[model samples]
Target: MPLVRIDLNQGRTAAQLREIADAVQEVMLDVFAAPPGDRYQIVTEHPAGQVIAEGSGLGIERSDALVMIQVFHQGRSVEQKTRAYAGLSRILAERAGLAPGDLIVSMVENTKEDWSFAGGRAQFLTGEL
Candidate 1:
């Protein structure tokens, strides 16, 4: 599953949020060939003063937003990952209206062996009952 966290300004409507999420998911599907069922998105809106960018040397800009995406997949090579990143960045810049450099997107991989659900009692990798 891909869990995407979008931290943006507290001004967008629900429709805007849904559109952004859909665009992001489309990138993953197109670039990485991911299935629709394996994707999930969480958008969190923050107040003006809650987030700050250190390197900017100024207060956080209203337009600044952080998008973090964690993808759990199997056997994806560096080349594939690189392509996905590029595609995601481009899509976010064009569709989401975020400056390409300002958007901080990250991907994390996990083997089924390292994940669990149901209060950690059910191991995903081992299929424990």
Candidate 2:
């Protein structure tokens, strides 16, 4: 399971936020092969001054529409991660009207033992996943 956190400048409507979240989930499903209903996402909107996103020498210009996505999950193959990035960029552009440059994504990998979905047990290790 992947837990995603979406951070953006505070402005868009709830529907727009929902669309962004849904698009991310779709990418996870397609690229990561995450099961349906395994969605774990959080959307946080920050004030203009509170959110600062720069290109970091990439020569890319970002706007207030910046979206930062952080995904925490088990390690994935480089190919899978690349595909997810492409899918996210494409889907966000089509569904949320976000430019590719306005998006930033990062992933944190952990072992299956790092997660305890319920009963204070590691579901994956227990073969309950």
Candidate 3:
């Protein structure tokens, strides 16, 4: 399973937020091969002054529409990750009206042992996953 965190400026409506989250989960299912109902996502909104996202000289103009997505999951191939990047960008642009330049994504790799879905037990290790 992957834990996804979405951070954005505080302005979008609830529907837009849901669309963004759904778009991300869709990519996880398609590219990461994550099963249905494995979604664990959190969305946080901050004021414009609170979120200081810059392009790092990439020459991309980031605005209040900036969105930062962080995914924590098991290791994935480079190709899979690259596809996720592209898929997320395309989906967000088409579905949520987010520009590719306003989206930032990062992934962190962890082992199965790092997760405990419920009952204070490691589902993967216990073969319950």
- Runs in model 2 lying further than 4 Å from the true structure: none
Candidate 3 displacement at residue 5 in angstroms:
0.5
Q: Per-residue lDDT for 81-107 in model 1, tens only?
A: 888788877887788776665555566
- Model 1 residue 111 CA deviation (Å) reads 0.4
User: Cα deviation in Å at residue 34, candidate 3?
Assistant: 0.4
Candidate 1: stretches off by over 4 Å: 56-62, 65-74, 115-129
TM-score, cand. 1 vs. native = 0.71
Winner on TM-score between 1 and 3 is 3
Error of 1 at 48 (Å): 1.4
**Cα lDDT tens digits for candidate 3, 1-129:** 799999999999999999999999999999999988899999999987887788798898987899999999996889999999999999999998888789999999999899998889999999988
**Residue 73 CA displacement from its true place in model 1, Å:** 4.5
RMSD of each: 4.4, 0.9, 0.8
Determine which window of 10 residues in candidate 1 has minimal summed lDDT. 54-63
What tens-digit string does per-residue lDDT give for candidate 2 at 1-129? Answer: 799999999999999999999999999998999988888999999998777887889899899999999999896899999999999999999999999789999999998889887799898999989
User: Please, what is the whole-model Cα lDDT of each candidate in the order they appear?
Assistant: 0.67, 0.92, 0.92
